[model samples]
Target chain A: AQSVTQPDARVTVSEGASLQLRCKYSYSGTPYLFWYVQYPRQGLQLLLKYYSGDPVVQGVNGFEAEFSKSNSSFHLRKASVHWSDSAVYFCVLSAQGTGSKLSFGKGAKLTVSP
Target chain B: GPKVLQIPSHQIIDMGQMVTLNCDPVSNHLYFYWYKQILGQQMEFLVNFYNGKVMEKSKLFKDQFSVERPDGSYFTLKIQPTALEDSAVYFCASSPWDWGDTQYFGPGTRLLVL
Candidate 1:
């Protein structure tokens, strides 16, 4: 079965510091990966996605993710963090040809402090 | 910009009572999905709907759970005889095309069963 794993449950970083949220997926075949962010009491918002080409994909709020097929990893990164960027980040995966059902990681809680 | 909306941001119900969570997908979206996230847990896929039928459902989608997109209006998730374990945040999302497309999620409906 396809699964997603987010190694960190909580990560604290200073404002204006660089950020990286780790994600790894387990799948039998080609995988479609996505990164989503959730604020308190808000819905999940898409940050970035990796389907086929370009190992690096850019997303909203100055976020980007690099997809590595060999390592089955799609790690999210931000050049600088803001206090407003503190939120829960989820890594999601879907099989190449399946429907819209996604298997999501347990999420990493990011705290950007001043 | 298109968005999804979920009705009844929060609800408290007695165990064994039936509850219906409502969602309105984007106007031009062709695929709809439901996901559940228990407090402090990752969001998990419940089901996906398209073309007036269910395209996929995860094992967590019990028999008591049903989804409908009647008249192309609200997409609803009805849980019959809700259990205590049913307490979670249910999110509705829609994609303009299919699974590979970026999904827009609604503010989730938090359901608590007592």
Candidate 2:
């Protein structure tokens, strides 16, 4: 069974500061990785995705994630976050031959303090 | 950008009752999925359906649970004889195709079974 681990439960960063959310997955083979963000009282939105190709993938709102096969990780990074970036970010994994069912991590709540 | 809409933002029912959650997936999407998320917990996959058939289901999808897309109108998850443990947010998602495709999620229906 593939599972995602997001060690950070909550993070508080000042506006305009750089941010990184660490994500690690337990899977023998490479799987589809994704980052989704959910604002209060809203549906989840895709931030970015990584499958095969270059390790780095760009997403909406200055968000990006790098797939590290050797590290078994795909960490989301933002050069500079705005107040609007405050939300619950989820790290998701979708393994092959599993009907594309997503396995989500306990989302990390990010607070961009002014 | 695509959107998946879920009917009934919130639902409250007594144990042993029946509840149906409706999801209007993206028009061109072919795969529909249901996920359960408890308060402060990670989202867990419940089931996935395509071609009017269930492709996969997790253990959380108990025997009391069922899914169907009648006439290709709305994808529905029906829980008969709901238990207190069923109190959680149910999210509906859809993807144009399976494997590596972005899944658009609905706002989720908060179900509370007393």
Candidate 3:
């Protein structure tokens, strides 16, 4: 069984500051990792995905995540954040043969202060 | 960009009543999925459907819960004898193919059982 762990439950960053949301997964083979963001009362939106290409994958809204097989981590990072970026972010992982079933982490709430 | 849509953005029902959540996937997508997210918790995979059959399901998919894509028009999840525990956001997602392509999600249906 595959599982994901998001270490931080909540993170606060000021506008224009760099931000990082940590994510780690436990899977037997190469994992398909994804980052999703959810504004309040809205559905989850795909931020970025990491498969078997470059270690660093860029996503919408200037977000990016780097996959590290050695660390079993795919952490999302942003050079700067805005108040509009405040939302709940989730780290997800899927195994090679799982089809469309993604194992998601207990999301991290990001609060961007103006 | 392709988008999925859900009906009855919010539904409130009695504890013992039945509830059906509907989803309309992208026009050409072949795989459909259902996921649940309780308040302040991680999103959990429920079931995955393809070619008129369920491809995979998680432990969270109880016998009381069922999924169908009748007529290939809408993918639906039905919960019978709904309990308070079943009150959560039910999300429907679809992907073009099964190989880890981006799965677009609908603006989930929030169910409240009282």
Query: Best candidate, DockQ-wise?
Result: 2
User: lDDT score, residue A84, model 2?
Assistant: 94
How should the candidates be ordered by DockQ, best one leading? Answer: 2, 1, 3
- Chain A of candidate 3 compared with the true chain A, TM-score: 0.98
Better of 2 and 3 by TM-score: 2
Regions of model 3 farther than 4 Å from truth: none
Question: Which candidate number would show the highest TM-score if scored against the true structure?
Answer: 2
Q: Cα RMSD for candidate 2?
A: 0.7
* The 10-residue segment with the lowest total lDDT in model 1 chain B: B95-104
| Candidate 1, B47-110: lDDT as tens digits | 9998999998988899999999999989999999899999999999999877678888998999
Predicted complex 2: DockQ: 0.88
- Candidate 3 whole-model C-alpha lDDT, 0 to 1: 0.92
Once fitted onto the true fold, the runs of candidate 2 whose alpha carbons sit more than 4 angstroms away are none
Using alpha carbons, what is the TM-score of model 2?
Answer: 0.98
Task: List DockQ, one per candidate, in order.
Answer: 0.81, 0.88, 0.77
Candidate 1 CA-lDDT value: 0.92
What TM-score do all the candidates reach, one by one?
0.96, 0.98, 0.96
Tell me each candidate's i-RMS in Å.
1.2, 0.7, 1.2
- Across A1-114, the per-residue lDDT of candidate 3 in tens digits comes to 899999999999999999999999999899889999988867788999988889999999899999999999999999999999999999988789877678899999999998
